[model samples]
Target: MFSRDSRAETRADTAKPGAIPTQPPRFSGPIGVVSSAAAPSYQPASPDRPTSILGPDISIYGEQLILKTKGSLLIQGHIEGDVHGETVTVDDGAHVKGVITARTIAIQGGVKGELKGSNVILHEHSVVEADIIQERLTVADGAHFEGSVKKAKNASEVTPDLS
Candidate 1:
């Protein structure tokens, strides 16, 4: 088998005595990196809990998973587990198959489970097939839901932060 690796004539053994050696020129582009150590660390301005978002690329499956957040929770990805947050929003295009417990719930995606909240709203693009227990429930005109809705005895008592 013949190889063309030597086609560039880079072999030093084939060079003539006292002759200059040549190499392929390399050009530098505008690639650079910034060091964080050069700057001081950042400090939080407030004590409020930051919101948690499950991005579109996130996917959780297999055994049931449980997620709990003190602040608001947004689901824009796929989650096959239970979620408990102060306020939970299932954004459009999101897929969740589990129980969702929150003070306020807004769903605009696909959900299949039990939803317990003080106030729950199914947006126009929502597709929910699960039982919902809420004090106030609103289903948009274009929303598709196949589940039973029950009024909670004490809506205000339906809290997301359950220890």
Candidate 2:
């Protein structure tokens, strides 16, 4: 039989540093909010790249990489550079001042440069002031466009000079 004094001594001996006591574990409920003593810091994601811009009428000596995003491309800023992509769409207030090359291009905004694409659609209220080259093109009513379009080249057009 163990006495009460023996149990107290055992508890004190088991309370040594880095030792697990033989007591029933206590459980705290799920954590809700965490408190921080210092102000939070801004941590950017890995492999961060710099974004460059061009002023109007400023000719770029080399290709300016605007973006390679997989999601929607929204440009409220001015771009005096060309864009090449799989699909491109411009919102109503956007103003692009450079050439665009894409598989499918839709413009509901104002563009001041040339455009080349496999399929092009110009929505109503859109305005274009440059030339366009595409395989298929659609211009909606009330859309203002003052550009010449060249249809897609056919096999006979490419196999020329055989007089």
Candidate 3:
């Protein structure tokens, strides 16, 4: 019959040479939850984190639905509203029918409205029917676009206000 001491010895025996020893986590300790009341909420707006996503199963349609975020957003659904973010991407098979304002906008879906961004990209297999105001614009081969594109003198001119 095995005892507690034997189990400890077995675990110790399994450790590799020069490897750092590990201790069991203390589950009895109080766990902290992220809350707005305790600390200021920090929204990460960086290339490492694609902070938000509208999944393909989601569909938002209303008179005026405004989605605003300081971070990056990936939309793989249908949205009939305005989107404001630092970086906004409309994924393949997605459909949007409103205005999109961001620092960077990449569309691989169907959009039928206005787009304002410092950098705008229409990928192949994308269908867009919207006026674009951008400092830099890229339209790939096979991208169907039926709208006028206006260039901005400065990148800040096309960047959306994240306030």
Q: What is the full ranking by lDDT, best candidate first?
A: 3, 1, 2
User: Number of the top candidate by lDDT?
Assistant: 3
**Tens digit of per-residue lDDT, candidate 2, span 1-163:** 8334665433423467878667532211111121223221212212332212222333333366443433223344455666655555665566777877666566767888887877777766679997987877777676789979888685232121212
Better candidate number, 1 or 3, judged by lDDT: 3
TM-score of 1: 0.68
Model 1 agreement with the true structure over 8-77: per-residue lDDT tens digits:
6654446788777685312111012212222212121124755566779899886768898887777889
Q: How many clashes does each candidate structure show, in the order listed? A: 0, 0, 0
Measured with C-alpha atoms, the lDDT of residue 159 in candidate 2 is: 20
Clashing pairs in 3: none
lDDT of each: 0.73, 0.55, 0.75
| Lowest summed lDDT window (length 10), candidate 1 | 25-34
TM-score of each: 0.68, 0.52, 0.68
